[model samples]
Target: MAEVGDDVYREDPTARRLEERVAEITGKEAALFVPSGTMGNQIALLCHTQRGDEVVVGEGAHCAYYESGAGAAWSGVQFEVAGRGGLFTAAELEAVIKAPAYYMPRTRVVALENTHNRAGGVVFPEDEVHAIAQVARAHGLAMHLDGARLWNASVATGRAVAALAAPFDTVSVCFSKGLGAPVGSALCGSAETIAAALRFRKMLGGGMRQIGVLAAAALYALDHHVERLFEDHAAAKVIAAALRDVAGAWVPAPETNLVMVDTPGIPAARFVEAAERRGVRVSAFGPHRTRICTHLDLPREEVLRVAEVLVEALREANAEASAGMGAGTSAGTVG
Candidate 1:
């Protein structure tokens, strides 16, 4: 592992190196390392806005629905949800900027998630980002990006991560997600913004000492693992194609490493249980939709195995349902 001195005092050489690299990649003046992507994004919000402020975010954004309301609790900022699929047009944002009304909280930040989680990991187009940034600038609102899966977006779209991040005032990127590092996230921004974020990080109990070990892993991933995300994307599309042929299975066209399959006419929990029994693991997202993620840890053989097990599980479920109906029953349980 790379070695560095204590980081709580900001002397860790490896951490500094990683921060500097992240800043260069994002075209930011500075960067700070945080424990997780959520922490990185939340710290940025806390540092950028005061209490009683509002942050505009997509309805399906991780910060809006999945971060356990940290923006509200830690930053004392309210969320103004934009749209169902976590997409907002520039016109939409312009309309939402509050007038000079004392009753409404001022919208201080506009946050977006690239490769939107609930939208089947859809990558937001760069033009949309630029337009929204223009609106944010006109309103004096800072823009932040929850770029946890940004590397995947870059690989899938053939766009540099910096190009996507350039329009935002701050961006949080993760190494543990698609990058396959064990842990670490970097928040990149202007020097003053990062200086303020470092303080908020300390207040949020995110300060660490001698964190070069984790930083080293993150650095390694950024160097060696980013280019291979295209393979994961290809694997996801393969899984989606396989699921499309399975009876009672619905798979959306995948854009990244995530594949969302809808097991219609079959309970998703049962599908997951059956898949696990076959030594393939998957998680149910809703009553019908289940999410399967392809990662560096999961090899191509494992991906194929998952697809085979899903097909078998679906076949068994359909047969069981058919047998039950033939026997004049509603449905039958499969062991």
Candidate 2:
């Protein structure tokens, strides 16, 4: 049985052990376990920012597009996108930094997403991260990383998780994503920052009683799942290869576990529905784009079968588009 104690009082041994393990892996002074990646990120925002401060982010960052605007509602901060794509260069970050003025919202933090979602899970290059960190340090701005899929990055690039996380003042890593833990994320940073984050986590109603059961899962994932992520990455590439020949589909070679598809002239919903009809599921990333992710549950033996179904789905969507039956409908939003 998992060890249980009052986590609200900071006595949960399993959570403490998980936090210590994550902190050691991330090379941070301390770490705090939270119920979700969203809460961990929001707590980081609250710790790094004051009300009305601005946080610069890459376009389509999870914090900006997917977090239900918690950064604004809870942290009282607004986001300024740094670049057009989901990854930006240091110069791009520099250009977005607000000039000092009493009338302008001060630029207080730069938030980055490594293995960026919605951009085909591309890893943020380590060199660019260091350059961006230098710029942030020069400007007296703090750095935060949404390293939810960092294990993927580490596996893909042959870099240690600590190396990837080193440039950031605080990093939030999720156990529920590639790691396949049922629920949990941890925010790692200096002891002072995490101490403050503990208060914000409670303020945001994230305090839990005995969460060792969840912590145990995260710990297990850290031990057994990290190295196996390469399997997911490989499967994504295989699926992407199979989908590349589908009509009207632009499938990029996946860098990690996510495969993003752009369906020109066909509604992404049409593709999604077609795939669903074939007992396969994928998300409509936008009106003309779809996102497919490979994870622990998607075994190697199933990758080709899934890819074939998705290809058929794309072909059906293409046929519908050709018949002028896929017009003026929304693909809807997916976080």
| TM-score on alpha carbons, each prediction | 0.93, 0.98
- RMSD per candidate (Å) reads 4.3, 1.1
lDDT (0 to 1) per candidate: 0.85, 0.92
**Could you tell me which residue pairs clash in candidate 2?**
none
Residue 325, model 2: lDDT of 90
- Runs in model 2 with CA error above 4 Å? 328-335
Model 2, CA-based lDDT: 0.92
Candidate 2 lDDT, 1-335, residue by residue in tens: 89999999999999999999999999999999999988988999999999999999999999989888888999899999988779998999989898999999999999999989978799998999999999999999999999999999999999999999999999999999999999999999999999999998999899999999999999999999999999999999999999998878898889999999998788988988889899988888888988998999998899889988988889988998899893645454543
RMSD (CA, Å), candidate 2 to true, equals 1.1
Flag clash pairs in model 1: none
Candidate 1 lDDT, 284-308, residue by residue in tens: 6666667778888888777787777
